[model samples]
Target: MTADRSVLPRQCRGQAGMPHEAPHTAPPCCAGPDRENHSGKDSTGSDAGSDAEGQRNQAVFTPDGLTARAMGISCAAACNPACSDPELRRLLTASGISAWQTDRLREVLALAAEASPYYRQALQGVDPASISARGGLHRLPLLHADVLRRAPLSLLCTSQDDVARVVTLDTSGTSGRPKRLFFSEEDLNATVEFFSWGMLSVGHPGDTVLAVLPGERPASVGRLLGTALENAGMRSVAGNMGQGAPALARLAHTEKAAVIVGSASHVRHLALAWQQAGYDPGSIHTVLLCWDSVPPAVAGLIRRIFGCRVLVHWGMTETGLGGALGCGHQGLHLREADLLAEVIDPVTGTPLPDGQEGELVITTLRRRTMPLIRYRTGDLARLLAGACPCGSPLRRISPGRGRTGEGITLPDGGSLYPADLDNILLPLAGLHDFEACWQPWAGTPLQITLYPAPAAGTDRTLRQQAEKALADSPLPAALTRHGGTMFHVARTAPQAGFGKRRIRVIPQGTPPLNSGESYHEQLP
Candidate 1:
């Protein structure tokens, strides 16, 4: 039986039935993507001239108890000679990226030394206090993934009673043993606050948001997203993607959803499903995407098909929840207040300058349950050179290339990224989405499969064109030699699990590949 849905409801209004372009009164209280910036210093926020500089620095949004600037965490004008301006120093020391994190980093190091056996042994002879300032994080050794897997419980700083959630991270064929992370109530609350800020970017009070991620499970992304929406005066519904698209459309129509959030491809799946079910995509004003890198073509197709704006969000289960979200101005804006970010040479682990592509490493500013110090995120990205157009002094980062572990490593040790494949395939006519896997073993050759977009037709000619194009590329030519190093490439309809987040690379048929297969090379 075919399902029918109506996009039109009695009210097509914005949140709480307020006018879409309505303005909030001056004196903004929170840091959200959607809120207007009125620093009250001058027309130009950051570029304000001399006399207004101090007053302009006070333009930072103070969300009640979250910022030290709000509470007046003080330091003498001469305490640190780095900055000539007192307000600038206060901003950096209080609410800026280095602000709270400088102090929090010290606390975590002390906690790791006191409680976690893994970090204690890892930090053997080092003094936690000496390495607690800005740039002090790099002095510490990298906490390898193996240590987290082998000594999982040894990473916990809090007792079981204080731990509210324990999430096992999927190595996704990158690591031998998966990492299990524990979080306290306060840690979870931090995620909720982050989400509140992210939601504020696209939504408003009393608007309904339909999420396709996990909703029913406790501490799940969807559930926490719902809680965050509630905190910001919005309603949330988790469609779960389990009951199929028609059911999801029904829920959205019933709730009058103004926004939809989902994993990378799942947003496309839901939007397309709603379209096919005869609902107007215009019913939803914005789309929020996370969990993977989106090709430029996919983003365009989604925008055209859905008649809406697309927001890219970056985060990990390890960082608690979302740490950064795109403000649609330039790159993704980092949550400098809660987390400090660094880009480092993947192989050498030395820090990279802004605008230089490298591996992203993070240090949680205020987490207590399981504090990760200078934890390697394995994602390849570069820091944006300047402030976001949205005018928040918080730093922004490039939407990353795929994970270092997700790259396809050849026998000779050169690598190809899934994003490289997306770049080649997404532009082709009749192409949808594709997944490539290599089963390199003693007898078997590497195997790759390309899936056509839904309703993109199963004609072999279109498939052959894609294959030939890929074969002509440098990546395939290197691997598809006549004798020693051999590989296989084929095309098929979308695989078994077509909708949700798809693993770009799989190894040995079952379990994910070990860390050796992952590549962290920076692209030009």
Candidate 2:
């Protein structure tokens, strides 16, 4: 049965002052014979600016057409800023082109098979023309991360000279080889275009944005984001989190930044520091959390401390830094024109119904340099059951997301995840960071070390508060009642790095050590 979207509950709406104008859309990168490109680059040499940018802006919205910006949609309403324009309903639903007729998909597949060594071998006997008739992207074999680790160069569909940048990431285990991803100029430009469109949700022209992410490298996320914001007619300052929270707060105050973007942990730390120093929260309008699973406690604390709208972004380097962007409501809106997404059973590799939890898989529709086909993301999430309250035609991904292989078995036959502790501990006042160790054979099965914020220092009362918070949670409370737990307050400053947190599980037979000895285990 078709659900009634107009009457759907307004979940996270009510934020005022959000603009209703459509963002700039890039010139058609996937233009076909049927779809002609009429929009010329703006004075900034990027996407055609918003409608208010004057007469030279030629990009027009056609329900049947798609562009690199996914044809930016403007949701017109004061209460629900996340909804797309009612016109998008036709573009994404009934009037959209079929998979067989999409020129972008055909172009990507042809390029991969023709120039990429890996795709040439992997797609043997698999005709691109038969894809639509056989089944859509689901019929293709799943691409595992191991393939990238084993042979990254073979996946390139462009000339070596055309490669603009290569990002290398170390694998989890010690002996594993690092995975490398290459991007060409056009590929990177597409990412910038998407970023420009996504940033419009939080910022406006002439607004200053502070990006608290790594910007030292030329191809770093911060640099690309800065370029995107500038092209969108905003002032952007890309700063590093390693400069510490206090320093960033000072910069934000000096610049009067309207928006701040960083990972959940880093932004949480900054918010705590900003509050401790008595900084006025009115200067900042929004905080964008990305790069990892967002904890509810952390998000709540940030919202309370900053008194600003908090939005979560779910994407990875493999996704070209732009996958699903938060709709400022309940879920994330997929970049439908640039990528194809699927949720499949993790155990059986079968496609799952909407609202069912499964692994996320992506197929790049416009990427030309290194096109990833049906790639497994190892993230456990689900497509939202019904249409969004905002009436957007784009598919939505539920906010509850976690890494698939991150669960650790407990003594009571239950399982614990990093999110379990993050939900309980991260919001505690005066707390900055923490590390958990699980030693099942010892008297204290769960050990935690707390790092206080610089302003708070290492106080004994903070330890008590941490214990009480954990004691209130069901799983940790049960474990403490039966197996006992340990809490230690560290005097050293908290690590400023924004990597994901995990609990270290010690082997059963290992000898118990004194709590005084440092028990910091390296995280993967």
Candidate 3:
């Protein structure tokens, strides 16, 4: 399912650094001092190469173009350990870039601390010299969601005039509130370079990739990815998978795309649709799943239909396109150079050793507009030490469970995470979709609404399956079954606004379930 080069120039091989050389096209508005080195025979049958070369040289040598190029190079090097190691850092310092960046970071931090009400109060009386000397990120007060929600964009050092892009990101399904993130032109360029390098590890140049995520929106990750694909010499088509399975299937067939990238849920839906349409998905060589965990059953389905390799990646909207990528021979490798990641006790905020499960904290070195210093990410995971089978120096984050919240109180009073239920439900056959809700009643019962396949339509069989899945768990005594495909379980809760829902345990006091309120309405 690799790209066929019959339609392009025989010399136009996929990405750079390959065995063959493709004719190089100069990027717009930027040329280097060595413009003659970039000049070559024009692909078009005309004597325009000389004129273009002259223009490129003039454009590249301009003061603004040179500054942008320098900044871009510096950002790339800072995010690459191969170029930003201690030795290289010293070399860069000698070359004047290290001092320049240090001054910039200091200036920005001071400006943010002074103008930002959130940081001003959080960093009250803190010495800037101490922050620079000790690198004591942990000592700095953590910036939580509440602060971001209340703060203004002016809190950042950069002005709106200087801001090139603003990206809006929905919090992981864990939270109901959405957040807006901003990016400068420099920030966006760095993201593009990082994305291009990561994809290059798996995809060749000129690969026809189909993006099945939410489209035609002003999402920063999607826009950056499209630009990266173009830079790598690849062609991409964006499809709105949120439109549903039928739309996605039609787009895939008509596009003849070799690669697919989207959320795990959307991809699973597409696989089901393709199966129903009697089309073999084997034509796709690579599938990239983002945002959510890849359930084992969905993975099996995608592999069976596509007969190709499926790769899963992890990152947040604030973290840019990708923070971790699954390699050809490894599970998932964290891009350590882009951000310094640490796992710590969620309750105590103390650092933990490798293999210990804890909350994830990240310090981004590449981010500029709103530099996140030791940001607390709610994800629960463990960091494993050592080199990967793929030979990457970056660390690996183990597949993890979701966060805990308010739902049912267990006998032992331990909260249940959504991952606890996902692990049990995803592998079950005949189950298409499901939603879990907690209702406050005299004695809370767990409510599970399931959408079953037509073949497994019997209510009795599904009830039996549900009972089996929760057999050993400490669910409440009363398991009430609804006649429809959906099963309702009663549970006590603090109420809708208390926070996230925990299905395992119920709170002591229970309230009555109102008939008008739907289960989805109770979701966080």
Error of 2 at 278 (Å): 1.2
Residues 280-354, candidate 1, lDDT per residue (tens digit)? 767776777776677665565556666666777888877887777765545776766567788889889998899
- List TM-score per model, in order: 0.73, 0.80, 0.69
The lDDT values for all models are: 0.59, 0.66, 0.53
| Strongest candidate by TM-score | 2
**TM-score, prediction 3:** 0.69
Off by over 4 Å in 2: 1-103, 132-136, 172-174, 399-401, 411-413, 477-484, 508-517, 521-524
Q: Which residue pairs come into collision in candidate 2? A: none
Off by over 4 Å in 1: 1-96, 174-176, 246-254, 410-414, 423-433, 439-448, 452-454, 461-524
Candidate 2 residue 318 C-alpha distance from true site, Å: 0.4
Cα lDDT of model 2 by residue, 400-449, tens digit: 43677776676566777788888888898688788888887788888788
Model 3, range 1-524, lDDT digits (tens) per residue?
A: 11112211222223132224445543332122221222322111112124433433232111111122334533322332111122222223212433334444455457667765556676777765555311455666665554455553634655677666666545434354456666676666666665655565445455777776544554345656776666556677887755566677877877877778876666766777777777765667777877666554566566567666666677876666567776533346665445556777888888788888888776555565676655677777777766443333446676566542322344355444555565566445555555565444423345565555434556566657876776644432323331112354322212212022235322445343453233554334
* lDDT score for residue 357 of model 2: 84
The window of 10 residues in a row where model 2 has the poorest summed lDDT is 30-39
Backbone clashes, each candidate: 4, 0, 20
Cα RMSD to the true fold for all candidates: 10.2, 10.9, 12.6
Superposition TM-score, candidate 2 onto the true structure: 0.80
